[model samples]
Target: MLLTLVLLAAVLAISYLLFVSYYPSFGGDVPEALQTKYASSENYKNGAFINQKDVPEDLGFWETLKIARKFFFTKVPNGVPAENIAVQHLDSIQIADYEGESRLVWFGHSAFLLQTKGKNILIDPMFGEVPAPHPMLGGKRFSKELPIEVEKLPKIDAVIISHDHYDHLDYESILKLKDKVGHFYMPLAVGVHLKAWGVEEGRITELDWWQQATLGDLEFICTPAQHFSGRKLNNRQSTLWSSWVIRSASESIFFSGDSGYGPHFKEIGEKYGPFEFAMMECGQYNESWPDIHMFPEETVQAGVDVRAKAVMPIHWGAFKLALHSWTDPIERAKKKAEALNIPLVAPKIGQAIEINSLLKPNSLWWENL
Candidate 1:
């Protein structure tokens, strides 16, 4: 019996090592040179990056297991739409031929295409069917289609990544998008994954918090967020996570990339307030982990904190990452925004939004689903 158990343990160990070694989606290691550069940042600890304020690691082993079991085995009412969410189709010609004011097209969740100053930029473009590194580990996306397929996208001016999470920084999406994208702007240490995925070093730019980069007439600023990052189990907090501000001479926009409610919004607002529009994270939150993702009410408050002229609730429509009903985020957010007198723009999954215009998409589109 002892020898039999020993053989079983050896087999399992070999399987684990082989999986991590051969799986390209697990991503690459951060080199010592990059580690030396990251060590200078205030947010970087002994080796990994950390949140502005630490998230309490208070969930005990059994409690965590219970939550995981509930998440995987329990079914929450309306956790997914009864029907597949509809998406407005776009062709490559439409994307390539735009000569208008700055605008955005929502691809649901945290993915967007921003066209401004004759340049097209993609933000957190996770175009895969599942957000997990392996399909068996997660469910399929709520929507079957995107505004346009990644292969059909036009020449991209730049790509902005918020962090190294599987939902935000997809390996397959990057491989498909790298050739079309001229440059990439990301938080510190995120470039290592891109480099590992065969993206050229010259095309990638890594910035610490408060750092800024420019493309043509647009200014991209990397700002702080109350979140953590990692693509695999062992690499948590190994790369910086952040929010972003994209400013042009005429208008500015903010994207709260998977952040918890914190003072950073007000700080960002003070530093770059009066934004034309902002997309706030409004989904996949629970009381079990309050410091990582924002509740819907907190989402609206973050919008107000940023002093945005109008706000759009994102991070809810594409996937079911939380226990609440999928529509709960938008419903709660709308109520709070109404109470606060904030203009809430709730566009459909693939709707195109004109950022410069006062006319916003505020229809209750999710109700139809």
Candidate 2:
């Protein structure tokens, strides 16, 4: 019993040290612009953004000990094995073959390989073993492996990041891919972390809300999302959070990075309506943090708000970040989409989805997983 207690103490000490080393706390005071904005904004009153009043008081040492004991003793269900999840591989998607049209391949979670107007773009590529700061520490990755390894990918024209969250912006994945990417676009202040991760400054492009930049024929419009951003506890909202509208002459796609149900979705739809396809957030939600993650039904509504002709749910099935059952997000999302008469598609992990013909019969591969 004494030996077990010593081992537990050592493990906890190591975990704390690692967290302190890798996880940066909130830096300094909030920016003046952000401070002014927060002061005037109604989000503060309604607990939309930062709820200083709602912040939990620091727990006493014994209180912390009790909580940790409860958590460690609790029997959380293990996630489904990666091999159990169904995946599909194509010889070649041939996105360059499709001119004046769009194609997308869902790489599970928020990662997508988008081919539009002869250019290949990757969005939030978290193709790593784990989504935590260190591979050995975090939960398991959802799929067995990417259909195509990062090295095997064709020359990528651009990489777009929604925020600085570990799941959205992986460190090892970026290190493996920094050389292959031509340009990296992300929300303002996110470039700091990317730069820390060794991406060249010239290749990184940071944009404020509603900002637009072009790469070849594709235009990436960074838009607002009702979400918070922070890598560590102290850095909450230090960087902006956003969704992106990737548009071309012939096709437009909306990638909802991660957001809850809010007026922003409708505003985004009004501005960039009638998208050919929308890859929206649809998982890892709980009532405890309703302002950050959207519920499954909210995802369907977000699809409608974006005026998406066809919608594919993401952010679920790949990672069990919330307490809900593994299949709960998709199951509830499907019901909501059907009730609203919204066109929806559920592709298997690593499945190639043709935007022009999204309704084709595909196996319900996630059922047995």
- Model 1: worst 10 consecutive residues (lDDT sum): 356-365
Candidate 1 on 1-369: residue-level lDDT in tens?
999999999999888778867899878878888788899999899898887787736476699889999899988999999999988888789889999988898999999999999999999999988998888878889998887889999999999999988889898999999999999999999998999999999999999999999998999999989988877656778899999999988889999998999999999999998899999999999988899899999999999999998998899899888899999999999899889999888887677889866444456778967
lDDT, candidate 2, equals 0.76
| Candidate whose lDDT is highest | 1
lDDT of each: 0.90, 0.76
The candidate scoring highest on TM-score is 1
- Clashing residue pairs found in predicted model 2: 26-234, 26-235
Taking all chains together, the TM-score of candidate 2 against the true structure is 0.82
Error of 1 at 282 (Å): 0.5
